[model samples]
Target: MGGRFQSLREPVFRQWFFSSVLSASGTMTQGVAVSVLVYRLTDSGIAVGWMTTCTFVPLFLFGSYAGALVDRIGPRRVLLVTQTLLATLSGLLAVLTATGAEQMWMLYAIAAISGTVSAADASARQVYVIDLVGADRVSNAVALNEIVVNGSRILGPAIGGAALGLWGVWACCALNAASFLPPLIVVLRHKTKTVTHPHTQKIGGLRYVWRNPTIRVCVLLAAASGMLFSLNVPLTPFTTAIFHLDGTGFGLMMATFGIGSLPGVLLAAAGPSRPSGLRVAVLAVATGVAILATAYAPTVTLAFVGVAVTGCASIWFISLANTLVQLESDPGMRGRVMAVWGMALPGFSVVTGPFIGWVGGVTDARLGFGVAGIAMILAAATGWRGLARPTARTPVTSGASRA
Candidate 1:
């Protein structure tokens, strides 16, 4: 155990890992706080859904552009700017909530601005990991990133909720805003310089992805996963209404999913390099099945178990796909390619959020979950053959070649 722990203590991994943890925790806390705040103020499922939509819509509209920017400018500078912007926005939100001047529209506007910054930031960070850890350990690094994200999911909501209970929502937002400092400081302090990709032109990355069959299929699979998994957002209303639980119960349920995700990350970390498309397809099907099972769960305990299963499947699918993208993409185009992947995930969420909310408002939240499951299964079935086929691999160019 000591040896294993020591291996991750290498300087490059340590910096990236610590930065990832801080960013993930802050982001998770912000998500929960925003969702809960919107729900409390509006008491409408659609309104809460709108909050989520506003937070992601920018990715769809500006993802390609953001990718181009990351490639041209380098990841380090982009991340620094992103961290500063996020901290400022989060602080503004904290102050607004504290003063009781927080309104629904204000929340929406802030979420939109934050989401725009996040889109560029996410693309940069995804590509930056390659610089830190080298290509050989990309899968392990991706898995570790997942672990950090899940750890935050486990702790962030619980902590945010506690802060909300003790000192009001403002406290949670304040802590989240403050949490950005560690990563920003780390990025600013890094002595090792980042190298920029040669291609600064806007359309190059998009053209490359359009021409690559494997990358295209991978992006589609990710988008489908995004759409299907959106059921979780609206499902919160059902759990609260059906199980007669409160915000604390919602936090605990999310924590349960986080618990199940840890093993999936470890599994990915241990696996050898292989084309991940087929693996992702299989995991997508499994996730859909798990969601279907979750819809039928009659008790909170059973529902939590179902969510745990879904979480494991979801993590495996997403981690494998991410690893494949990072491994197979042209280094010059990686930032943009990753931006496309990030866009698909959040972009689908923006469109699906209101629809899922509508479904829950009209009938039952279980119906939303069931429908999403079916959609995911259909998507997986349609793409199975394409995803399974072996394709020519792209060689890395630019600084990534050094790895």
Candidate 2:
């Protein structure tokens, strides 16, 4: 137990992690408010979908560029600027909401801005954790990072809904705007002294990903997870068509999946923080099987068990892959690597939801889950040899290596 959280003993990571939890919670809360508000304003579900799209599209478009920027400018500098920009953007949203000047076009513009900021922020914050903790605890830190993100995701919506009911959307926006303060302050006051390396040239993120077999596997897994675990699209069919249940039943299935993730992450954290290809492969395969079981369950009660198992396997795969990417990449190019790596999530978000829904629409919801499981199984097979091989990684004392 003590070993699982040894990373928290580092003061920088402790503060940063604590601040990130609150910031992420606020961000999620604001997301709920934005979605609800946009739907109300436009009275269109499609419009709301577009609003969500606006928030993720920038990463798919310019994520690599943003990451390269992080490496050149330094992650700390990037975080300081990006944090302020996001806070100001949140404030701008509040102003627009309160002043009755909010429009669909304006909301979209803000979403796009938020997405762009998020792209830079993702790479910066990820690479900065390396700067803070060095090599030894990077895996633990990455696992902890996932816990914060997933935990906050689970809570943020409910909190945002309550705020919306009591104080309204503007209040949610305002509170979200304020939520950025702790991290911003923490970053601003963060001081580090480290040796510098003279860089003669820069390497493209994709080039490194291609050259490194481990990183390539990690990225593939990341991308594939996005497509496979897009299980939400098939839930309606599973609940209504298969289980003959109501909306509340559908919510139960979703919540069970989310609840299951907590244990998966915790288990991963408790284990080795170091990259293990076998672990990733096993988890991927297990997740696929769980998806199949959930799809073919004889009863709703059994389906919940499958959902929970799927959740546990999903996070285990993700956190392990993320840790591998961080550990394997050269510190000099970590930002670009993480940037390219981060795109996997959003990439699938845009494509898989509707694609999976269509699969369920054409065939049965069970088949869609089966197909996703097969895809995952196939993807895992490709990495079996690579993951089975033991590889050595060099640890860094500073954030970067000397040239």
Model 2 per-residue lDDT at 377: 81
lDDT digits (tens) for residues 1-403 of candidate 1: 3322332655766766876787688777777877888898988978986777787889887888898888888888898899899999999999999999999889999989988998899898888777765666677778788878777866787787788788888888888889888877767776334567755574665677767766776777777666555646666876776787888787677677778777777777776654467777788788889878987789888999998887788787778878887777877788889988887786877766667767778988787666667767887887777778775565543332222
lDDT assessment of candidate 2: 0.80
Off by over 4 Å in 1: 1-9, 35-46, 99-105, 191-193, 198-207, 237-252, 296-303, 359-365, 397-403
As a TM-score, model 2 comes out at: 0.94
lDDT (CA) per prediction:
0.76, 0.80
Q: Estimate each model's TM-score.
A: 0.86, 0.94
Error of 1 at 186 (Å): 1.9
Top-TM-score structure, candidate number: 2
Please report the TM-score between candidate 1 and the true structure. Answer: 0.86
